[model samples]
Target chain A: MDNLFYAMIFIIFLTGFWIMLRQSNLIKKIIGMNIMESAIFLFLVAMGYVKEGSAPIATEANPGLAYVNPLPSALVLTGIVVSVSVTAFALGLTVRLYKHYGTMDVDEITRMRSEEL
Target chain B: MITAHIMPLTILLPLVGAYLILLVGSKHRSFARNFGLLTTGITFAMVCYITYLVSNQGKMAYYLGGWAPPLGIELRADPITAFLLLTFAGVSFFVLLFAYDILPGEINGKVITRYYALYLVLLGSLLGIVLSNDFFNIYVFLEISSIAAAALVAVNGDKLAMEASIKYLVMSTLGSGTVLMGIAGLYMVTGYLSLDFLAGALPQAYASHPLTVLMTLGMLTVGIAVKAALFPLHVWLPDAHGSAPTSSSAILSGLVVKVYIAVLLKLLYRVFPLDFLAALPLQGSLLVMATLGIFIGSIMAIRQRDIKKMLAYSTVAQIGYVFLGIGLFSEKAMLGAVYHVFSHAVMKSMLFLSAGLLIKYSGKRTIADLSGLGRVYPIPMIAFSVGALSMVGVPPLAGFMSKWYLGLGALEANQLLFLLVLLLSSLLNGFYYMPIVIGGFFKKETVEIRQEKIPLGAQISLLVLIAATFFFGLFSNIPISFLTPTVQGIFSAFGGGI
Candidate 1:
């Protein structure tokens, strides 16, 4: 089960990375980057999993206390929050880019900026 | 008198200052400037005092609210954190002063206050990263810094700024994610999240559980390399630093990149042992990447038309200096690496600011239009010359001091080949930097700049930095000794002697 989970994460991360590499559209590239980020988060959270463990928070004494480490969950929470913030900010920027250049393609933006230069 | 508030005060002062500026900041330029400058000025003083304490007292760790490590987040005041914090405060303070004229006109009304607010928060976050003792705390601070920095990059709200900010945001998030995964791996293996605990646990864990150790190290190293902009991982730096405002460029290139290097050093020396590192399959890959970055980044820099973008690419090469030092893994190399952290801040800040000033005062953004600029603006021209020469590793300058030490470190390691690479890159530096300086000064005045007026703050900062470059170059030993406590502390932490 653990191997299956790690394999899934690796596969998903690779797929996202693949999209980032192959995609021509700038927005799609950004989405692919975010996907890659999520995949890594998945791998991380998966690393902290136990076969039959429960949530880390404790209300009862020794309530089947085989729990996954709480630290990674805390870290992933921070990571997800930050990832969302950056995504929003990047999307804001993308909207502005579309307004200015009228294209969502990386190649076009490069050409336009180069020509301006 | 104050005991040891350097640990928390370094972070808290900036946070409070940022808030005060945000709250009280109106359209009043004088008001905003006063608050921002006062906050940063005090922080600079605090950093100097912190430096003295680090030199005198060795490593000092402070728990948050007096909570001890393993349970509470820790702030360690070893030489590395102190040195990095000093540069961050110093560079950001001067750059804040430099931005006095840029921010008001760059954005209007409340946005200027927002800019100052975000800038100070970024400063605070960087301080937190360098000083924090918990891996989770470091990740939180890294994210905060990255977001604030990206927002500031796009603050002026333009297409270039937007695109650059987005690219930086995406890549930086990826870096943070990778680092988070690494931290989780460590936590799962050792059941500890604090740096102090990890430092103790890592040795035994690495020996017993090789695969887990390898995976954790790989993730952490990749995450850090991504942040430090090491060669292939550096696709975002050029766009973000190049497209930001001049003051932001000064801060981003001059201070931010070095902080990543500092963090990477902390991770490598404090968290991972050299024995374990040597056991890795990709031991020399980092140095090889540094070499590639130096050659490729320099050549790429030479191909640029926009001056700031060129300087941004130059950073990719300069960062190679840090990695090269780390790769050699000698005290002399580490010393060179640490010293370059400061010198790079001073010299690169001056260079970027000069480029920005040239862009601002003269409206000449391209090299072709920079003809006869020196004749018109002699002071900035001379300053740029000193900076360019220093970067070219000319004598009696900070850049040369760093390169010299790095070369000595290489030779000390009996690595003559690395020494050759250093010399070759200095020559590459000449190829890239000299052309712009020579072209600016010696070329005929075809399209003369309309105005040559520069602000008093900008001019003073440039002169001070230029003099500082030469000062550190000539008096290398004193500055080096001050950093000795730091180098010794980190070296000792690794169970190795300096």
Candidate 2:
């Protein structure tokens, strides 16, 4: 069961990678990148899992209880912020490229750009 | 005592300056340029002091908030770190100085303030990358620098630059994701992010989970190779570096790419056990890739008509030399790799700056149209010639010293073929570079060119870089000696052989 979880994560990551590499549309490419990032984030979060752990918070009622590791969660939060910024930036560039080339297709954009040169 | 604070201050001052510029310079434009110059100037001073302290007193580390590692982040500065920091600080200061006069003309006037802000952010983050001794901190800084670098590429606001910027953004992000995953893998196994702690734990982790350790190494190497533009993975570099503004190209080619190499150096030597690395086929793969990158990058460069594009391709080849030094895995080769980092930073930035000036004055961007430019623009042309000759491994120049060390390193590692590759690449380097110099000086004018007075600031910057090229060559022993102990320390663990 544990190996299956890791395998699923790997498959999801590969799916995203394929989308990113094979996509022709700029917007689709951005989506693929986000998907790829999400897979990594999931992998990170899963790494900190304890089999029956509760929230990492401590209280007077439970002084020394097992809790999920908090570090990976913290790392995941930073990762999400970075992912968002990259998505926004990539989207901005897509918008600009669309305006200049009048197409969202990567191949079409390359064609038009090379002809211009 | 004072030097202990210099490490953090070196990073923070530019960051603070960047924010200050963003706040004030949005209203006042001239203030941005002046403040950017001042910020880099002070940062350079602090970096020099750090280098002094490291050379005399050995390595130093600064922990945040007085919290020790395994819990808190650590910023360590050994001799190699100090050397890289000096390279970054010195080149950036001079590049900014060159930009003072040239940048306003090249980039959009409306974004001048924002450009300075991004430039400082990039510098601060690069210094942070050099100083950070923890995995997570390095990742954060790596993302910041990558964003800043992509933004700098797009700041020109041209269609080509914008396209290149997007491609770079996407590809570099992919690289970063892989790097992050690799870090996570290492952490999952070792439960540590600090280099010292990781070093202690990785061997044990490898004992139990060998495949994970191997996968992490592969991922990290592949990821950094993409960012560093090592041959087959360098699809994004030429377009991005060729289309960016002058100073942006200088920084991207000269410093940004090198910092990733610095990170890889730390990962290979400090985090992983050398014996384990040697036991794998890591050395062979690295050498093969380096050799391929060297040859292909040069051949492509020779085919380029655009001057900037040609230089961009040349950078791809030069990077191979650094990787070659690393792959050789000998004491002298590693020293050569580190020294090449410094020499190439100086030489390439000087070449880019001079090329920028030539393009500006000549009103042309092709190698063919730059004939008779030598007489009209002696300073920039002369600077360009010196840089080109240095690239060709001309004796008594900085490039020669690096190639010499790298050649010696190849022999030390019993890799005679790579020594031949070194010599052949130098020849290929001349094939592309010599024509520009010869045509610029000896050939008659092809197109009538109007003369413009070169700015004193630009002149001063190029002269300083030219002097630096000679200084490093003449006193190559200084940096080589300074880096020897660090390189020796890394190799001593492996019994100094592959």
Candidate 3:
């Protein structure tokens, strides 16, 4: 069951990467990057989880309870911050590209630039 | 005790200098440039200090926040880290000085301060990547440097800079993401993030979970290869490096790409066990691919018309030489790669800075447009010629020495084909470079050109770098000696064999 879950996440990651590489629209490509980041986040969080494990926090009610690993969840928070910053920067670039070329399609932009060259 | 402070200070001082520059620079334009100069200069001094200490003490490691082990982070410096720090600080000081004159014209006056700030931040993050003693911290610093580098590329705010920056950002983010996933995989398997602990734990992890180990190695190497622009994954490099400002072109081509290679070296040498690396077909495959990169990149350079684009393609070829050193996996080869990193950093940055000056003064971007221009701008033209010859592996020059050592390593490893590749690539290097030198100095002028006065800072930095190119070539023993212990340590870890 665990193997299946991990395999599905890997497939999602590959699909997102394919979209990022294949899509012509800059916005969709950024979205694909975000999706890929999301898959990694899911993989990390899943790595931390354990069967029948409770919250990682300490409590008197569950003194002897098995707690899931917490480090990956903490690390994912940093990953999310990095992802958000990259997305914001990419969007800013896209706005500039649109203003300069009047198009969001990457192929069109490349064609326009080469024609100028 | 003072030595313990050196590592943290090296990383933090530039960061503090950046903020101070930001605060002071917004008010006065000239202050920012001086502040940047002062910051990098001091950082270089500190680098010298640490190199002295490391030579005396062997290897130094410091615990951050007064904590130890898997809980608190550490900063460590062996011969490899210290040598690279010295190179990083030295090259950055010169590049920052060069930027003082070039950037104002390339970027708007208002945001010029911000550009200096980003440069320092990038420098600091690069230092962090080199010195950080753990895996996750390396990831954090890698992202910080990548984002700063992208911002520096986009500083011009033009259509080309914007496009290139976005392309760089997307590809690098993908690379860093894969790297993070690899680190996470390692962490999950071993429950450790410290490189020392990971090295100890990895061999056992490989025994129990070979598939995961393989995946981790694949993802990590691929991610780093993308960042380093190794061969086929190098599509983003020419556009980004060519379109960026000259200082940026110099820094990115000369240092940024090389930093990733340094990180990959540390990982391969330190974290991954030798048996695991030998078990996989990774080294041999990289050797073949890198050989192809050497050939393909040179052929591409010969086709380029734009001067900056030609240099960018040449950078791709030079990086192939670095990877070839890594693939050889012998001490001599690794030492040659390290020397190549230093020499190339000096020569390539000199080429870019001088090229930027010519483009500014002569208003020429293509090689044909630059015909007979060397007669007018003697200083920059001479620097360009020196750099070109050194790059072509002329006798008594830096590039020649590196190629010699790499050839020796190929012989040691019994890989004669690579030695042939090295010789052929040098011939290819001359094919592209000689024409430019010949056209610049020998060809008669076709068009009347207005020569602008070169900035003092730009002139001084270019001369210094050109001198360094010759110095490293003639005195190759200095770097070779410095790298010997580090390479020996790596071999000793693998039980001290060829």
Candidate 4:
């Protein structure tokens, strides 16, 4: 079951990378990047999972039962926040780029930019 | 001692300064510049005190949140950290002064406020970069530094500056992303993110998780090289540094990129096992890149019409000297690289700020406009000549001393090819700089115009830096002597091999 989950996430990562390489639109490329970042976050969270485990919190009952490692989960929260910040910043740049050049295509921006420089 | 709180102050002063500027600077256009300078002045004094402490104590390591190393994030002040901190503060303070004198009122006040905010943030992040003892935390600071730095580059809001800054933003983000992935891989293998943990787990990880360890190391090495602008990955640097506002230009070329290089040095020398590095392909590849960067940067500089662009390109070649020395893999060579790091930081900032002032007053951007500048702005022109001479490695100047040691280090290791590269690059330095100096003095000022005296603050800072350009170069024994024992200490950890 763990292996299957890992495979699914790996597939998602590969697809995201492919889209990132293939996409011409800046927004799509950004989405692809977000997808890849999500996959990595998934991988990190999965590292802390355990079979038949409850949340890694203290309680009076079930003191001896298995629980997930909490550290990687905590780390993933930080990673997720960083991903969100980058995504937002990239979006703002996209808006500005469109306003300046009137296009969302990366190639068009590059072409217009080269002539401008 | 009654007070050891200065360690945290080094980081805090800048943070407060950055935030204070953001808070009050927008409304009071009158107060922003002076407030920023006072904050920077306080930070500079703190840095000087830290240096004083290190010079006496031999080393200072402070743990955050009351946890010791291997668990808590450590901020260690070794000689290198202290050296870099002083450079960052010194350069930023002077650049801010220069900025005050020359900032065109045409540029919006709010934009100028944002510039100070980001500049202080960059300075604080650079301090964090130098002092960090944990791998993942260093990456966190690197992200902050580069993002703020990229934003500062484009703060001018011009088309070219915007393009360059955005390009820098992308490449730098990519590099940080790759480095973070490598850190994740390392964490997965060793269950640790601290440098001490990485060091202890290395033998076990190398034996059991060779593939994981190798991949992590390779990713990180290349990522840092990318950030440091080692030859091939350097395309974004010249553009970003060339097009940014002059003060930003000073910080970018002077210390920001070098701080990244220091991060890489810390990564490779302190964390990665020396034996693994020796067996890897990365060192040889770095040598090739340094060789190329030196020659290519020099050739490109010779062709630059814009004076600042030429200086930016010259930085590419100058930085190549540091990489080459590091690649030599000898203690002397590493020490040489480290020494150049300090000397180059001070000298380059001076050159950039002086160029900035010249461009501001004269509105002339090209090398030819510099023709007969010696007649108009004699003080700044002389300052420029000093910086250019130091760059050309003339005797008794800071540049020559770094080159002399680096050249000797190459020969000490019997790396004659790198030696040849250094020699040729020095010649190339002269090729680019001599023309400007000769022209500044020899060629006649074309137009009859009023000779504007530089603002007092700008004039005073330039004088101090000029005096320093001579002092750090000629005095020789003061700074250089302190560095040797630190190198010896780190070298002993490697069994005194290099």
Residue pairs in steric clash, candidate 3?
Answer: none
* Residue-wise C-alpha lDDT for candidate 1, range B1-498, written one tens digit per residue: 355676788788889988887777765657778788888888889988887887787767788888787877888876666777888898888888877776565565557877888889889998898888888898888888888888888888877888888778767766776787688778867878887688789878877887877888888889888888999999999999999988888888888778778778878777777656656655488889988988888888989888888899999998988898888877788888888888999888888888877776567688677768888887777878898999999998988888888898888777898899999888988987887789878998767576746777777778888888898899988878776655666555663211
**Model 2: per-residue Cα lDDT over B1-498, one tens digit each:** 666677888899999999999999999999999999999999999999998998888888899888899989889888889999999999999999999988999999999999999999999999999999989899889999999999999987899999999999988988998899899999989999888888889889999999999999998988889889888899999999999999999999999999999999988888877778889899999999999999999999999999999999999999999999988988899988988998899999999999999898878999999988999999999999999999999988999999999999999999999999999999999999999999999998788787788888899999999999999999999988888877887888632110
DockQ of 2: 0.79
What tens digits encode model 3's per-residue C-alpha lDDT throughout B1-498? Answer: 656698999899899999998888899989888898999999899989998988887788889998896877988888778888888889889988888877788788888888889999999999999999888888988998999899899987999989999999989988987898899889878889888888889889988898998899889999998999889988899999999989889899999999998888878878886666877899987887788888898999999998999999999999999999988888788888887887888889888888888787767788887778899988888899999999999979898898888899888878998999999999999999888889889998766778677788888898888888888899988878877876887876752211
Per-candidate interface DockQ score: 0.56, 0.79, 0.72, 0.36
**Candidate 3 Cα misplacement greater than 4 A, ranges:** A51-65, B495-498
In candidate 4, position B473 carries an lDDT of 84
Docking class of 4: acceptable
Task: For each candidate, report what fraction of the true interface contacts it reproduces.
Answer: 0.71, 0.63, 0.60, 0.00
- Higher-lDDT candidate of 1 and 4: 1
Q: Which candidate is the best by TM-score?
A: 2
| lDDT (C-alpha) at residue B189 in model 3 | 83
Fraction of true contacts reproduced, model 2?
A: 0.63
The parts of candidate 4 lying over 4 Å away from their true place are A1-25, A50-54, A58-66, A113-117, B104-106, B446-450, B495-498
lDDT of 4 at B268: 77
B382-434 in candidate 4: lDDT tens per residue? 88899988988898988778888888888887888787888888888889998
How high is the TM-score of chain B in model 4?
A: 0.96
